[model samples]
Target: MVVEQFLTYLQHEKRYSSHTIQSYKIDLTQFGDFILKTFELSLTEVKYVHVRDFMVTLMDHEVSANSVGRKLSTLRSFYKFLLRENIITASPMALVKAPKVPKKLPVFIEDTKLDLLLDSEELFDDSFPSVRDKLIIETLFGTGMRLAELLALKDADVNFYDSTIRVMGKRSKERIIPIGKGLAEQLKNYISLKTLQNFHNKTTGLIVTDKGADAYPGFIRGIVQRYLAFISTQDKKSPHVLRHSYATSLLNRGADLNAIKELLGHASLAATQVYTHNSVERLKTIYKQAHPKA
Candidate 1:
């Protein structure tokens, strides 16, 4: 009942995306089931100790710390709602600590390999689908746009003469990013081809797709995998890695961090700052190899 109410609150008040709301509902439902089994109490009767015990059981089952931490976060938010409604006088999860998650650097292909991947003429073909696929890869690597942003692009969002594309990022915030000359030209050619093929549907905004339909997440992932399978050995070769590669390349070439942050539509410089670590490590490697000291 609590989770049902929470789901409604998230949909109506929070305005979370349907996918996000569904994920929250599943997570909370699992937690509710677990708590019910452990304590044999109704949702209204759950106490702090029961929550803590649930966490212990999760640990006993060897759930990853991150998983436990996320579940705790969901529970905390749920209980916060209860507290606000005066359903509970005290918060049980208020004192609960979240598991520490280690910061992992974004993985990216080297510039040489990226160039090879992008420049492989064999990858490009004269067909509409092939051109569209190539342009999608080019745009993602060119602008570091998130997969969702790329999939949401419209023909109107691109300006070939200005060499820029407007992207709607997280939270529906819009930002315009300049495209490189290479990618700009590629986009122009792709657009011209799209016009010739009559692929642009009036109602759809997606730039690349089969039969004018919008690309779902699975289609995007498959595209990335197919293109990357040739050039990357990295296990995580998704469109996000193309984003990482773009940011890393920009930082390596002396682009300002703040500028990159804005270009990538990151909310804060801190999120953009991680790429600097990758740059620093590269510099250290060069220093060690070039230095005379043994």
Candidate 2:
């Protein structure tokens, strides 16, 4: 199917994450189903009116503006791909405006709780996998790299002499991030242990499975969730919250915004400013707790 082909295009050429491609596939499939049932037309035959009808149908079904907006975004990307490859001459989503979504503050763990999590060995086991898992949490929380970036790390990417780690961010942009003495020690130990594994099946990735295979996204996310569940009770307990914790912690400590932006590999200051709001919210909560009067 053309949709499957496009998904492959995203996977191979665009470097879109599996999670992102799956969302696109689901959105396109839902829209295609709606088109087939209501208008008896395939995706290629969909018009501007039919696209509008799809939006209306989603609204009638009580989908939120944010969710419907995301689906519209998928349609826009899909139709743009079709138009680009000359499969279609025009895009039905060209005139559509997505619904505005309110910004929500990012959720993050507190510094003290993170301290507790790291200090408590009872939170982790005393095996090879547990040692690797402990370092995974340390790298994610300490370095603030995304899960994809972490999984992509090669041994050569770390410069032990300079105390820095190189990571490839979105759009294939490469950035060098500095690591502290603590993370350097952890990486040294991890590398020594990994070298002891069966040299035949060794993978290039820094994080690996029990069999020494490259760690996939789900595996890493499960690792994140497993450790984070012991400390945090937030509704959202993903790897990104650790990233949020990194950025927010820096902001709360008076670190330069642009410096944090560079550490995070954000393309713009606006993208990094959300941490400022998070910091202010944290301050307000502390004030309410410690102040003599409400």
Candidate 3:
């Protein structure tokens, strides 16, 4: 009941989005279930020792530090809410420390391979699904829009005259991103074809299933994974790699860091700075291959 009240606080007072609230619910529910099984105590009887023991059990299960840290953070927030409501005398998670997580660089497909993949005749199947899939891949690679932003696009969001797209990103924040001439032309052709097939649904959204419904995340990911699996042998073959490719390609071609930061909708230049490392690694490889120091 206390956890339920805290969840309501997160939903109403914090105004957390549905997706975020669902994640919090899952974390808390899992923690609660674990505590019940381990300590044989009800939610009302949970104490600091129970919380600590649950964390140790998570570690014993070989859960990643980052995952454990996130779960702990969720618990900490829940307990903070309980403390505020006077349901508990003290917060158990206040003294707990989250594990440090290592930062990993984003992985991307090679430019030459990506070019070959895009230019391959297999991509031009002339089927409705094939064309739609190709356009999605091209758009993501060209613009670096997040999956949600790409899915949330409407027919009017793309301005062919201005070569720009209006994307709704994290927290529903909107930004304009420029599309390349080639990608614009492809999108125009796809849109024309889509319209002719009566798949517009009158909803004004651009991306849709064969039945004209808005595409879901699973549907989009399945299409991306299928195409990338055919073209790439990399461990990471998803739409996000296309985003990485977009940023890295821009950096490789002398685009300014600040420009890429704005285009990618990154809150900080530091978040955009990772691509610089990718470019640096590429330059180092080129130098080693072409230099005559040997």
Candidate 4:
């Protein structure tokens, strides 16, 4: 009952998405089960030792540090919530520390290859599906929006006259992303084609299936993967890769970090700073290849 209430708090007060709330629920439930089975105690009775023991148990099972870290974060949030509500006198998470997660530069498609893919006239056509597919790639690479943001996009969110698209981001935050004239034209054409088809169950969603249903995660992923496979050999090819590509492309071309943060709708400059690593690596390669004195 307490767990359900906490999840409701996450949903209504924290404004966490369904996916995030589900993950938090899973983490909390697993911890609850662990304590009930081993210590025979409820969540309210947990202590710092118990939290540490849970961490050890996770490691013993050979869970990745990244996964363990996320679980610990879930516990921290849960305990914090209990403390705030006076359900618990203190949080057990004060002494708990997350395992270090190795930093990996984000995977991105080279601009040249992406250009080749987008510019190839034979790759896309005027048909609704094809135009829609191309626009999917363009919107992702052009706006740096997340998959969830793209899924939530609606016709009303777009302002062709202003050359911007209003994107609803994490925690219900909203931001306007500028669109290129080319992309705006593409969006105009795609919407025109979609209206002409006039499917029986069409919605106001910006992107839709051939039958006019709102696009889901799998639908968007499949479309992105299918198109990316034609040009990119990278193992990771999703809408997120396009988002990374968008950020990297901007940073490489000297866009300010804070500006990129706002454009990407990142909550902080730290998140936006990762793209600088990509730029630095590229400069190192240039130095190695072109420097006369090695």
Which has the greatest lDDT?
4
Highest TM-score: which candidate? 4
Regarding lDDT, does 2 or 3 come out ahead? Answer: 2
Global lDDT of model 3:
0.85
Superposed model 2: Cα runs more than 4 Å off: 1-19, 81-90, 290-294
lDDT of 1 by residue, 1-294 (tens): 667888788778767667767777777788778877877777667777888788888889999888888888878888888888888888888778877777889999888987887778798777888877888778888899998888788878988778889898875678999988988777778777777767675334646567766677888889888998899877998999999999999999999999999999999999999999999999999999999981
- Residue pair clashes in candidate 2: none
Off by over 4 Å in 3: 8-15, 40-48, 80-90
Task: Kindly report the root-mean-square deviation of model 4 from the true structure over all alpha carbons.
Answer: 1.2
C-alpha TM-score for every candidate: 0.90, 0.86, 0.87, 0.97
Q: Give one clash count per candidate, in the order shown.
A: 0, 0, 0, 0
lDDT of 3 by residue, 3-99 (tens): 7787788878877667778889999889879878877786667777888888788889999998999888888888878888888888777678877
Give each prediction's root-mean-square deviation over alpha carbons.
2.2, 2.7, 2.6, 1.2
Comparing 3 and 4 by TM-score, which wins? 4
- What lDDT would candidate 1 get against the real structure? 0.83
lDDT for 95 (candidate 4): 88
List candidate 1 segments past 4 Å from native.
none
Model 3 is weakest, by summed lDDT over 10 consecutive residues, at 38-47
Q: Quick one: RMSD of model 2?
A: 2.7
lDDT of 4 by residue, 108-226 (tens): 99889888888879999888899999999999998999999999999889999999999999999999999999999988998889889894246989999999999999999999999
Between candidates 3 and 4, which one is better according to lDDT?
Answer: 4
